[model samples]
Target: MNGANHSSGNIIRLLQSASANAALYESGHLQVVRLGNQLFEELSALLEACGELSLIVVENELIIDGRPQEYSLFINRFTALLKARGVEYLKFQKGITRQEVASLVEFLSGAAGEPGEIASTGHLRFGYLTVAAGGPPSDSKGGERCAAEVLKELSLKELDRFTEIYRAVQRRQKLKVSGIADVVSGFVDLFRQEGAPLLILAALRDSDEYTFTHSANVCILNLAQAMALGIEGQQLKDIGVAAMLHDIGKLFVPEEIINKNGKLTDEEFDLIRQHPVRGARYLMDIPGVPRMAAICAYEHHAKFNLAGYPKLPPSWRLNLCSHLTMVSDFFDATRTRRSYREPLELDQITTMMLDMSGTELHPVLTRNFFQMLSDLKTPS
Candidate 1:
């Protein structure tokens, strides 16, 4: 195996062992002490190999070595165990002492004792152990005021209006074209000011607000991508509207299923999978809504490899808007914290998307999107 993969595997194992050690210690198992020692030794070896090891927990993702560690069911549980305690990032450098490791395990044991409890420290230090607080880092330019304050407020307000429109549609009210148009115009203006970074930075903000926030983030990402691809004029508006309303069908879904903190049963998943068709049907009723919006709603989940949902009939194909929206959808979804998992680091998010480029997403579009993201994210 390659060094990177080997390191990735060791990190996963170390995390699993650490979590187990915490569980053992908490139950007053005497063997926990021995296990804890072993865990520290293993950690030391890993540090030797890698120079430093950091585990950063974002909303639903566990990041190691600036990469997204592939999820294992057990690993997700362990990640949740850490996230629940508000343990954001753990940094281990060479010569990290066993005593420091013991302290961390003890701390994890205490934290594991109380599920879903938040730790208060922004940065906690225990000898050689540094547990920096979690959540997205402060905006580089904004400092005390977030970089996207104005943009975020504007997007959220637009999202609120868009969300209400969806609700009105659900209630069978008259379609409001003016409000939706205003939202698209507002997004156009926002994009004009800073291009992709304006929306990208805003999207990177914490996703605790959910549905509405997710729609806005995806819309921004989609719009930015669309603009980059020379998709302009009415076409851009159509794509933006499509991106914003891509998940509107979720409103028809049960809150219990959509927001359930645990794994979904097969039946629950099937029900959840119907959103695209449901959303598309609703969009079809809007007097002036773009057909591409409805098309994107229907086929955003249809994979490039034809492995995705809302099974297509023979010889059927996906729309360009759907391909664009699909990439944006998955990118923003994984980038944001959801009810069930943490958000991935930027590198991790890109790597996963690149890996999916050929099969799950449009190869050219995915590659272009990553290039755009890289340019936007680079320090100016």
Candidate 2:
């Protein structure tokens, strides 16, 4: 017996306690596993002599049967491998509180995105609680992105709609400000009414191309903001067009700039900075790309404090969409990695956004946006 087995309590108790919230926990295997009070501790090599078998350590005890010794060796070898990579040893131990287990789903979402396999077969078989069923961290995210793409491909209607919306805003440079109420309303309808299906979107979060996937993420953010403000109907339709095409400007920037391997000079930086206005001008010709989107292109970079680029008139205040887009844009950009920097973790980003609320974001809207994001992250 290991010191943990001899000590006061072990992992089994912790796991069993959390099992009350059966939706969050599952007993992965069986074979007379008994645990201690502290589940997180490591107790191995005991199995090496016992031979091989399927085994799992819940919060307190060691459950083992069938080829127990080989199973022990497998675990020991696995521990060594993970340790070399800065990973801690073995099954999330007993020390991990019930709260931590619940948080695993959200933490995994950041890792898996939408196409992740958060749930084991056991979880699926035993009715688990899903945050936003089929949303990211579930099986359907990829499908959702595909559906959105399919809709984009088949809906010539939006193309014509965006064309008119695009031209209307170009005469002046205010960000497709016309018919936007309608654009946002439609954006609301897609998810709220169309039941646009969240599982598909969840699947993409798990795909290989995470940064590109941020595009759909941003669209969702923008859409949510539009709906919360009650901008519906034709106005919603226009917003959806604007939201979907907001990044169309990036098509013009060099891939090197987008995926640069390293830091850039002031000149390179200036060129990079031009994306918003550049995005605006590029869409100037796209008949279907909404001018509101074009405007978003120009003004999305324009900060609420009036410090961002394309320095507009002194009296100009950012529109609601532009202001909302600012947070979404930065959130997506910072959370994804570049060759030079690792992605900023979500908790860190959440903390940073708190400062920009009044200065860069629409205050109330920012609160709701953060709330939605936070709620989504809380384990189901």
lDDT score of model 1?
A: 0.67
Candidate 1: Cα lDDT at 360 = 93
Q: Cα deviation of 3 in candidate 1 (Å)?
A: 58
Candidate 2 differs from the real structure by a C-alpha RMSD in angstroms, to one decimal, of 20.9
lDDT of 2 by residue, 26-61 (tens): 443221122221222222232233221122221112
Whole-model lDDT per candidate: 0.67, 0.48
- Among all windows of 10 consecutive residues in model 2, the one with the lowest summed lDDT is 122-131
TM-score of 1: 0.58
**Candidate achieving the largest TM-score:** 1
Prediction-by-prediction clash tally: 5, 83
